[model samples]
Target: MNVQSNPVTASDTNARVLSYAEAIREAMAIAMQADPTVILMGEDIGVYGGAFQVTLDLIDRFGPERVMDTPISELGGAGVAVGAALTGLKPIFEFQFSDFAMLAMEQIVNQAAKLRYMLGGEAAVPVVFRMPSGSGTGAAAQHSQSIEAWFGHVPGLKVLQPSTPEDAKGMLLAALADPDPVMIFEHKLLYKTKGHVPEGSYLTPIGKALVRRTGSDLTIVAGSIMLHRALEAAEKLATDGINVEVIDLRSIRPIDRDTILTSVRKTGKLLVVYEGVKAYGVGAEISAMVAESDAFDYLDAPILRLGAADAPVPYNPDLERASVPQVDTIEAAARRLVRREV
Candidate 1:
């Protein structure tokens, strides 16, 4: 295996687009190529080539030692990754599905997340935990939960949910270099969806939100799959003379409160959208932030929230569609907030 051949340095020229999974693979390749100390560890990541093939061709390039496949114990695999990270080896751990991360919560949130802080900043756990999150594959409730809120609540962990291919690659690269624990929530539906990603290595700083669309009527704060829906809704609302600004909260933890507040103050109205259940979801936190910030006084209307219903992700496509905030739901929510119609 030639690790030096797959360097991940960014070029000064144009950036080429890539798929979400390909972007992830690119980050892994670059990281391993850039630093020999980086290794991959997870279940089915070796000969099986990963459950979603995100680690495809990596084992062939780095061999079994660097691209090791472990038993199907999330706890054990995660713990091993943490121990490796503590010893100066950058271990990228893959959780087959976000739902399975629950089984290793103690290791992830308690151990990996707290190691540096507990050690008085003497020890750092530079591990990137990647998991396929969100619903769309009919994976049922057990396999289709958006658990970003759970980890975002933890103090020592950084939670990232990139909505585009560019960010998928950029964020992963940045997370790999972070000195603390980082959890990346990769949307399952976006794996095959193609987009233009930078051709070489780059980093999108964590904790900064991006304004996807600019407008003055209302502001929509969203993340993950819901970001796409918010953009679609903004376009439809534009025709009705409503100018809506869509903000993508790419970094859930250490969220960009300044950017969010600035947008809401200009728009005078706010609508927070997320894919998780309405109660205590990302939207709730965003809405509260706006209300507490100076942006609250500039609101022309109450800060509205639209989110998934508090129920299991249904197996039926129609039922599932209705359970979450789809484009139509987002459109309606935007229109209502803009006073377009009911």
Candidate 2:
């Protein structure tokens, strides 16, 4: 994208507007400057500034050593990052696109997930993987996909999907501070989106969901770009007096069950939206969570799930848009469920 947003430094006084990429860059800079052990590893992250330019100007601020670019192999790079974490260095590895993570499943799912347990807590793997994920960029099937649910199913890894610039910076800092492996699924479409991000270092508490809008008629839960879509749908539905409540599901793996359950009980209706395919996706997990919990009794209607189409993401813009849930679709689904139409 080659956006030239100014870099965030500690000396800045007030909260400033920043793009999602700039915010992530600020978090990496802040973490690297604060801790010498913190380093960055990714393909073309140094001078090339990452595939989406999220790491732009980072190599200059921290030098090439701290912001080391690795070979083109995702598996090799991932294995090295995991080893770096075990050998007393905190490595933030960025995958050009999350779809490439499949090549490194052995390192991420096997080694990073089982080391501590296999040694009975004698060791820790504090690695952070920053992956640019989701559709809408016309990267087609090979590059456009939402795989947070894949890593979320793994026990030892923490999966986060921060939608706003504020949460993007804070949650990345939180992941850096965590003692286990963390996967941050940053949506490609959100890279240039802007929001107010506070100065200095901060941590958006891991595993906590934020109530974006409060209402009592229906509850809408989503993460990443889908969360923004849900919010937009909620706003439009508000004028019709639908009174939809929106929740930003910041952490996927360690889900904020209490927040979801509380909202479901208050609203009496639930709608889970996600960008992943309909079957075995995040929507299903959220639906099942409320269904299995005491919140089931509070449900005035059946929980509805709005997810991506089963077909691969198409290069055609119209087809790509049709494959994923959009604002209109989300609003329609929420309206139907709240009105007892299902």
Candidate 2: residue 168 lDDT (0-100): 91
The residue-level lDDT of candidate 1 at 326 comes to: 86
lDDT tens digits, residues 94-174, model 2? 999999999999999999998999999999999999989999988899999998899878999999998888889999999
What C-alpha lDDT, on a 0 to 100 scale, does residue 257 get in candidate 2?
Answer: 98
**Per-residue C-alpha lDDT of model 1 across residues 107-164, encoded as one tens digit per residue:** 9988998888899999999999998988888988998889899898999999999887
Q: In candidate 1, which residue ranges exceed 4 Å CA deviation?
A: 1-13, 340-342
Point to the candidate with the largest lDDT: 2
Q: Please, what is the TM-score per model?
A: 0.94, 0.96
Superposed Cα deviation of residue 252, candidate 1 (Å): 0.4
Best by TM-score: 2
Each prediction's whole-model lDDT (CA):
0.86, 0.90
